[model samples]
Target: MNYTLLNSIIVIYVGLIAYLGYLGYKHTNSTKDYLVAGGEINPFIMALSYGAAFISTSAIIGFGGAAGAFGMGLLWLTFFTIFVGIFIAFVFFGKRTRQMGQNLEATTFPDLLGKRYDSNLIRAFSSLIIFVFMPLYAGAVLIGAARFLETGLGISYITALIVFTAIITVYVTTGGLKGVMYADAFQGSIMFLGMAFLIIYTYVQLGGFTNAHVLLTDMVHLVPAKLQAIGHQGWTSMPKFGSALWWVVISTLVLGVGIGTLAQPQLAVKFMTVKSNKSLNRATLIGGIFIFSMTGVAFVVGALSNAYFFKNFGKTALEMVGGNFDKVIPLFIKTCMPEWFAYIFMLTLIAAAISTLSSLFHVMGASIGKDLYESMITKDNRGSQKQSMFLIRTGIVAGILLSLLLGYILPISIIARATAMFFGIAAATFLPMFMLGIYWKGVTRIGAISGMFTGALSSIFWLVFIHKKEAVALGISQAIFGKPFLIETFPWMVVDPIIVALPLSLAVTIAVSFFTGNTAIQPPHLKKCFEGIG
Candidate 1:
């Protein structure tokens, strides 16, 4: 690959994003505009932005690497992403969210929940959770992109991390959500098109799909002895029932990310950006198609790359990629694709990173500044648009700095797991409250708070104390209370924290709400906001 050409293309792409950020700044006038793009974003841009924010470098790099390690079985995640994350999200959640958001005059996720229930505690606590946990998600995304750069371009990880973070922060702080959305739309298009091409090119390079599968099957007997001994088959074939890999893929990766998308603060907030339910309906088709292509292609290409590497090097692609899992896709791209295509792929990867990072930072900023700060510290200063915008920008900077620091400190091997952990936590904590709050008027403040706290705390406790990595990191024995944390008979994969926590949260929410008295007092502006929108 021509380093000069690759570097030049990246520079041009980033410069263009910077220019777009400047344009977004010009359009940003009030806190509403900064936080929600004036709630007038085009449906196409809104859909693309939603997809871009949802499918980060984590999806392409982190999960794609996961596909390499786990095989095509992880493709179930793509199906769920389209059906659950996109279709259900838009059809079930989007319209109600838009109506409720407008009705409550809410700009951030926390704002919607707090104002919906008329609880300052909800606003402050929700903001606190987002500010604290979102950085871990953001850090994982940073590691995904930086790991690609280190593997693909031979750049230092720290340097790549700094550069990528700096570029995204500059745009996000200046351009706000509208800027982030516009950039995301553009970057998302590149991601979709680039992945489509990469998939096709990979198949062709491997002497077509049939031959590739045949080759992979023939090499089944060559499966690592250790893996085979552990009940692993070939990469082309699915894992055996009760296998460790099988459980991890199905439970943690697929279910974790697939179900988790509904509660993502970054994606959920996007539903509030559109003008109407009709816009959200329209976006559903666009988002579904885009996600299907981007995620589907990544998984297909990742699986097929194994065949290609084995043909050339007499070893699986994972062997050449240094077994880091995160490096698999980058290694595949560098070795298989032409220099020009690799350059474009690099741009696509960067676009994925920056687009998602911008959205994450923007949401984190809004949660901290608009939702928490204005509601708590500056409630009386709501009329001061300039002051609120300044605070939001300051929050963006703080979020970027915190995430960067976390990215620097977190171990690279577990980057993908960390990313999955964030999503799992978000789903467990926010999904029930968000969904029930929109549709069920009986949802009390105590119910919401209990659900949020239980879901969030339980998810974290499982990931930290009960998870295998945490056990190893903390030097604790895996056998606790006879077998793991909660239940002995149930598999760890079956009883993942998200599975446990989400239901528990919902149960607690209903139980507490029924027992406690209602604190419901609809906001004065509710009817005015909901009157015209159907």
Candidate 2:
């Protein structure tokens, strides 16, 4: 097993992370520094950090497993991740977000929105949403890494989850955003190298790309009966367009996380970490390469793993991993890749999980303590940076525990579902107001509030009542109404909430703003927010 080599790699990685945390701690003199790295981080660090945080174990393990079962249809998500998530995010949203954050002196995403609209309620509500729902996403990230540890190293899931969370919480709570970003940059580099090797090695192992694709395509007859019934065509092609598989892949996986990336609090806050628009522009290529390598490799390897498994073991990747999609990639690496590469790839997964977890914890803590507590719970503490920072750190610990608990409670193969849920809900809730508030000056405070609340609630309602995953998992609909899901119509069960909720949110914002008609005055700070970045 080369225990010494594995141990040494892990130890060195941990040491490097600790050193970054120390650097963050040494530099974090004020609350602003703790929150946004004093808004002075270099472009390279911000780009790598953002990309790393955006593609976590959820992408590598969760969505990778999804590709295993669903085939290359998940590649659409990779395209969205690069074009919308990285390209548009950095070029369009990043410039305005940084301008607004610096102009408004906003430390958090909620702070930016709240201050721009001059509404504490908006700030508090946004924070509450983040605190409440982000754990689901965080839990997905935790479970992905935990599965890797459990499968690759023979560690118990519970122990892996706890150890992973503890390490991340320590650095994030102490070093704050600085530590999170620095660690993320380092982790992102490891991910880039690991994934590049993974894709190349996978192809070499399964013959060339053309040969592998042909083999996978020809193996369509080998797909499980259940998957075939659900419209799976083959490993190298998209599913049947109108099938249930297509609906889940397109509505939930593709549109959900793809569009949802725009409103992500953790990623959005990264825009505020640096000072100039040029920094964001410079980051685009770096971010594009990082995302493409990470997501592109994950989907390719995941789909191809099936062909590998079938060739060697007469089974698909999902069958080999016992139908738990989240376990597919971990099992693949452990059973297939060389010993040294397997160990290195395990560390890559760790880096992916920890980087994302650190950002989620930091954002959640800031939302709770900085926005919720200071702004709403105790307005008198608004000026107390030390007290607020303490509270935020406390919130970080609490968020970690909550996510760990969720990781334990959730069912298997729930990682991608949970990830989509969080992303969809976040997009539904915040995307309208966030994009409108930045681009459209006509967005009123009332409209923003109403839109966010309406969108957020509708997303929840859809998840509980219509979305089959939560409908079946939670059993609320069944308990109350004697059915697994409240909706009994075609495509309703398969349709994602984002398709409905996001439009409703956008409509409400536009309708409410038009009706209000100059009644709501823009804040003075907003004008500064719109000013071109110096």
Against the true structure, whose lDDT is highest?
A: 2
- Which tens-of-lDDT digit does each residue in 1-534 have in candidate 1? 587897788789878888778888889888788888999999999999999888888888888887776678778899999999999999988898888888777889888878877778878888888899899889989998898888787889999999888877767888888888888999999898898889888888878879877887787776667667655677777777777666677667888889989888888889989998889988999999999988888877777777888888888866877677788888888889888988898889888888888888888888887778766765555757777788887888899999999889987556667777888888888888888877776777788888888898888777655665554454434545443334334366344577678888889888887777454664454444345443
Q: Which residue runs does candidate 1 get wrong by more than 4 Å?
A: 229-231, 381-383, 474-490, 493-495, 517-534
Distance from true location, Cα of 517 in model 1, Å: 4.9
- Best TM-score among the predictions, by candidate number: 2
Q: Can you list the residue pairs that collide in candidate 2?
A: none
Q: Over the stretch 73-92, how does candidate 2's per-residue lDDT look in tens digits? A: 89999999999999988887
lDDT, residue 464, model 1: 54
What's the C-alpha lDDT at position 436 in model 2? 88
How much lDDT does each candidate structure score?
A: 0.81, 0.91
How does each model score on TM-score? 0.93, 0.98
